[model samples]
Target: MELHELESAWKTLDAQVAQQDVELKQLRTQNLRMRMRGKLMRASFGQWAQLGIGLLFALWGGSYWFDHLGTPHLVAYGLAVHAYGIALLATAVVMLLHLAAVDYAQPVADVQQRLLTLRRTRIRSERVCWIVGAVVWVPIMMIALRTIGLDAWLANPAWVLGNLAAAVAIAAAAAWVMWRRPAWFAKLSMDGPLAEVERQLADISELRA
Candidate 1:
């Protein structure tokens, strides 16, 4: 073959290889994005479910508190329940907002950071609820008894106080454990969709590097 012809053929082969590489990268990115979107959709659905449950609790607590305005003990119990419901509602709303703020079109690193933030927020909220719930259930139980025509608090103040003390002790112990060994209450597993998305992002990052 002539020298010029040989050079032309090599150029053509290089261009083809470059084009294929570009196409492959694009395809991988698209696939990763689709999978990430699916994970986000599942997470969003879960947050929506949480929001619905929070709404129910808030309404129930609000009604109970409004009805027991005349009784101080009942009012206190209702208010405690109402506060917990509000906390749940607020946490769900904040999580939904964070999820909504995630822009999939952004760089993989950026998206991964946002998702990690969301995961941390979820974990923190769960921990807060765990500690609070230990005590919150006492009020919930009190309200339930009241609904069943048993004013347990008024009937046996000592029993009610004992139960309340136990709840406080339990909540205090849980808080101490969480403060000392933060990983013990790690409810969210690393094998979830979020983790999968993170792995995909890491792969993409490595490719770019």
Candidate 2:
């Protein structure tokens, strides 16, 4: 073969290689975007479902309270139930709003910043959940004890002290469990995807640079 013909063949092969590289990069970017969208959708749906359930409970509690409006004592009891439901709904709404605020089309740094903000929010929300649980549990336990005639039993000093200790123990256990539960679940659903997206965004930033 002529030397020029050999050179031409080599150039053709190089061009093909370059073209394939471009195509492959494009495919990878597309795949990453699809995965990111899937993560976002799943996270959004899960949050919405949580919020929806909370809203339902809140409404149920509200209805019960309204029905007992004339009964001041029962109305007070109803507030304990509403306290938990309202806290759950509020926290979920805050999370959803924060997630919605993230602009997916933004620059990598901006997206990362938003995600970090979200992580902080989740941490704060988890703490708030425990606090709310602790505050609400006392009334819940009181209501339960009342139903079992333990409220009257508490007229005795010893019985009152024992009941109060039991209530405190139950509340502490519940708060600890509630605190750990959401963090564990978020590791699988929320934190995992957020971290993956951050890594992907970093890669994209490097490529752009």
- Weakest lDDT window of 10 consecutive positions for candidate 1: 182-191
Highest TM-score: which candidate?
1
Each model's backbone clash number: 0, 0
TM values, all candidates: 0.87, 0.66
Task: Evaluate residue 20 in candidate 1 and report its C-alpha lDDT on the 0 to 100 scale.
Answer: 95
Q: All candidates: CA RMSD in angstroms?
A: 2.3, 4.9
Instruction: Quote the RMSD, in angstroms, for model 1.
Output: 2.3
Model 1, 89-181: lDDT tens per residue?
A: 888888888878788799877887897888788777777777778988888998889879999988999998999999999989988877787
Candidate 2 wrong stretches, greater than 4 Å: 1-9, 66-73, 141-209
TM-score result, candidate 2: 0.66
